[model samples]
Target: MTSTPTTRNPPTSTASSLLSVEGLRVAFPGRRGAPAARAVDGVDLDIGRGEIVALVGESGCGKTTLARCLLGLVPPTAGRVTFDGAPLPRSARALKAYRRRAQLVLQDPSGSLNPRHTVYDVVAEGLRIHGHAGDERTAVAEALSRAGLRPPERFFLRYPHELSGGQRQRVVIAGALVLEPELLVADEPVASLDASVRGEILALLLRLRTELGLSALVVTHDLGLAWNIADRVAVMYLGRIVETGAVEQVLTAPRHPYTQALLSVLPEAPGAPVVLSGEPPDPSHVTAGCRFHVRCQILAGGEAERAGVADACRHRELEILRGGDAAQVACHWARAEQPAAGTGDAAVGRRPN
Candidate 1:
């Protein structure tokens, strides 16, 4: 990899984008003498108003860190994140107001909901924090109703231990909705729910978008969920986005080796499931060239070698894959005007560790 800080080009916010991340990076100081861990490195993403964007990646791929940075919960080491044409503020008062407009719905309803708090109290906490002066009861009830808890008053006094998994999730959603935020950042929103409950929560998310014009950035490892709900999908690996495009285009016919390997493992996927050899390299010690090169099926198949780009695959640094309707892949061979030698829909298998 090479360094050219002056040449770093971040994505500029588009008019339709409600939230934008421009060349963002977050590096954490390493333990002991280890190198600093690059949790989120050079990620560019855009979420349009009223649109749903899925940030899909394996565990430890830094999707959660990226989401945290977007919500201003963590500071970035480089670049910037903007919301509604304005950069995220640093002042406590301004950040508090920013949080009011951009809420987070966590993955586990049980972990998120306070066990002792009544549904009404849980949802009203945000309003109280923001010093909302409007009718508190009306606001809480409206949020509950919107989150699909009909006859909101019935559940108002019920505690978290009294609600079903789906109901608890609804309560969590209502807490975020109580303030009527413009955007929601949901990290692994349905990971803990049963299959039946997962669909319902996903439906609730879709319904919210349709009815309230709420934009969202959903972080998950499930590609199937991305196809079902997101307008677009961004595939992240080891602190970087390797592929991104409209969900249909990227999921149905992927180009990047990493993206192809991921989609091929879906139960309904057409080809043999690709079992990657091992976990991704440690973020603190990222290898050069493509972040995914070591695990890339295409590279293992000798396609990069045949295409005369293997050295680049091992030594060159790749730029961030920008988000758009048309599919984009960050790869030395795949990005060449000509496709890599003997390229196919997918090239996958076990590689030597």
Candidate 2:
């Protein structure tokens, strides 16, 4: 499980970023006097024009909440989200205009599509709402064609129940495409489809980016999907980004303890999977200092003692720090050379006895 430090190439400048989120936070009030649940805690992110960035994490890590914030579907407790160098729209009229440029592709096509509506109606609904319905037929057919449903008119009058799972998903994408959006925030876009269908949908997304020059923020728990399509990867833990870098670098040689543990478990991983001992921490009552310290193999294995940073790992809050040329890791000991095999009892990158 040993890995060397690697450099990360930063994304384009803020002015050039198609979408930017700074210090974003979202919290829900807790019940019974408990602390508020912080779904997204101080996340900062940027997506360049035509870039596909995958937000990867386990369920409940707040990837969806972060996406919602970017979509203006949920209001953030704090922080700012911007598009094309301007703050998100506030008034109803302005927001409507903003939404036309940024659309969402949901995870479940079956649940998202109205069973009663024809495909034409589903795709044209956005055009009608945005005042582009005058040429609805043309726009609907074009969008459906762009989504890989060639000869789109043939399916125009078909209902959701009549389409294959893949075609239904394409209809959902067609609905988003009808708006001619510049940015698409797709939340687990392929999770519900068959494995065979998953590749088709992903290829469509990439084609849209190449042909239409669209940028996207895809949220998912599957690291393989990120490797397949995303240009960059942001690994989320709890509500914060713990590691982010170019997809090849982050997936091949992750820097964060959490990232390493995750990759170690992949089927073709180099070593026996590194298994952490506890469940992920609750967002409502996040621990102080490094949120992952309680389960970190390096700290648990006493590598921190060797580095003389054990105290810092338990008390001092660590910021997202540069670990290599292109990678940023949020850990006090990330830069330390990997501990020699059998160095500590931490089980950081070792199989269970």
Candidate 3:
């Protein structure tokens, strides 16, 4: 079958978006009359061409699900995902073509690479799958070089077990690069590597972006990683983005309590780590009103009550952070704090609550 393009353009994104998602939701069915588990609920995100956006959150906060949705590996239950100003293709052929333009780098390299396949075969697999008409050896070599594997020919006969952890990851990246994707959705790209190797992998990603003009959506729980590479950071809680802004602004001066609690634990954090009580935040069983209300330190620590916004905090569901350059926090308490600091509602991108 021949590949085709979809002309559908969603109303949710700006023209600058290389990849965007609007109100995206993905849910899994529950047994015995139970409500489905919504892994990704009401998310809005964008990654511009040549820009790196980090999606930061703890485990089960839907970071991976959202990444999967963006790559079309998992379909959203509601809302839409767009690439290059076009909606995700519905046809198989179109999807295949879209995938060639956008690729994924998984968290674990050992599991992602097959032990039986040589490095040459692994990197050349995508070219073979896509039926590349160009010279295979040259394409493979260039990809390997781009991924930082020096003298790419030396690794051609190496198996997965023959390489170091970082080398295996570079091979995985080379595999994706064989297709010359425009975007990469890297899920915890450095988590599995040694501390020393982590920086190397990150540097490789940054270099790729600069040299190839590639866009990336880096999904990780490490704010430190986001600080190092991402131009922007979106801090997620439960299943929604609670705060977003330029990486420096959001990481240095996070407004959402959820974000604050997350950053407090950093070794260099000015304040001590916030010890959160009660159950962990989960998207599978989201409730009405503010999903973070029950666990919110602002409410529990009596800050919201003192600000006279406790009632609103408990009942109002905040909208997604508006896109663009503004540093926004989707919390009533943040708005309340803004007034005291003379920043006002407009400063926080406060929406109707």
Candidate 4:
């Protein structure tokens, strides 16, 4: 997205991430017979230095809330978010510093940019807030130019309403970049844009990542989009991470049932889509054994089919392995006969657990 190219800068060591999370949990209040809603229940994730990790799941699965917790915008009832080996504190001073190092690009571009402010003011706000004393003229111009609003001078004085949707969105990106964050948490930044513009923006985010040497956590429900940009993919289910691995591995050979269902529906490689039946179970009313058991096609038969086994046994013999390892299905029989790593065949060809 740039003509006069600039060399990418490596991230400062002080801003790098270490083991980022462990068993994160968040809950809302409940009453009567209803239990408190646990939006994020025991989620474990880590986004290392210079990594692009995508967190994909259905709506209301706590992806956004998890992002909020990561940024310290919301307090976590359980778990910890660490940066560069240090735990993040809920204190205002710690949070302010965290805000500078890690920034969030909201879902709605239009809602993010101020209607009253000129483009220059919108991009300049971060610098002003952070007590930056550099020449405002040069910083604003550079940020806008880097975002591809070239000869940035022409666009500086225009209001948000004057620019096209794409341009306005870029303005929001420029504003975020001006602060020069080490990590960016983009919460479905392209979900609201036109189909044509979506790719353009995705390209922009990727180019910025390469040129700026920035690490990112891209949150979206679209598996296709995650495949396109993320170096690694982490699939979330009912607020927990069900699968994670390199983009090629997780997308092509999913280990988790939820992950399998998601990839099966993708329009990848221009094939007919794999249609799925039933919606995700309600969080409050999630079933015993596994949250997805009700809709899962891997249920075991009752006493007549298998006499010593429980009437309903959860296939829990699977284990997480590195990408290119055997097809690590979360089903008991599949794990018992786990295939050799990189076998390119199913551990147990799609069958009932």
Clash totals, every prediction: 0, 5, 0, 0
The residue ranges of model 3 lying beyond 4 angstroms of the native Cα positions read: 1-13, 339-353
Task: Summarize candidate 2's per-residue lDDT along 168-257 as a digit string, tens digits.
Answer: 999999999999999999999999999899888988998898899898999999888888888788899999888876788788877678
Question: Scored by Cα lDDT, where does model 1 land?
Answer: 0.83
lDDT of 4 at 246: 64
Cα distance off (Å), candidate 1, residue 283: 0.9
The ten-residue window of minimal lDDT in model 4 covers 1-10
> Which candidate would rank higher by TM-score, 1 or 3?
3
Residue 222 of model 2 has an lDDT of 86
Give me the candidate number with maximum lDDT. 1
* lDDT of the structure predicted as candidate 4: 0.71
**Structural similarity to truth (TM-score) of each candidate:** 0.91, 0.90, 0.92, 0.82
CA lDDT, candidate 1, residue 176: 97
Off by over 4 Å in 4: 1-19, 31-33, 269-276, 300-353
Report the C-alpha lDDT of model 1 over 1-353, residue by residue, as the tens digit: 01111111122235678998888899999989889999997887788888888899999999999999998899999987889989999888899999999999999999998898999999999999999999999999999999999999999999999999999999999999999999999998999989888878988898898789898899999988887788888899999888776677678777788888888887777869887878999999988788888888878989989888899999988766554334567778776533423533221211111
> What lDDT does each candidate get?
0.83, 0.82, 0.82, 0.71
In candidate 1, what residue range of length 10 has the lowest lDDT sum? Answer: 1-10
As for candidate 1, its clashing pairs are none
Q: Candidate 2, which segments miss by more than 4 Å at Cα?
A: 1-11, 320-326, 338-353
lDDT string, candidate 4, 270-330, tens digits: 4444344577666666455555555554343232124322333343322222222123343
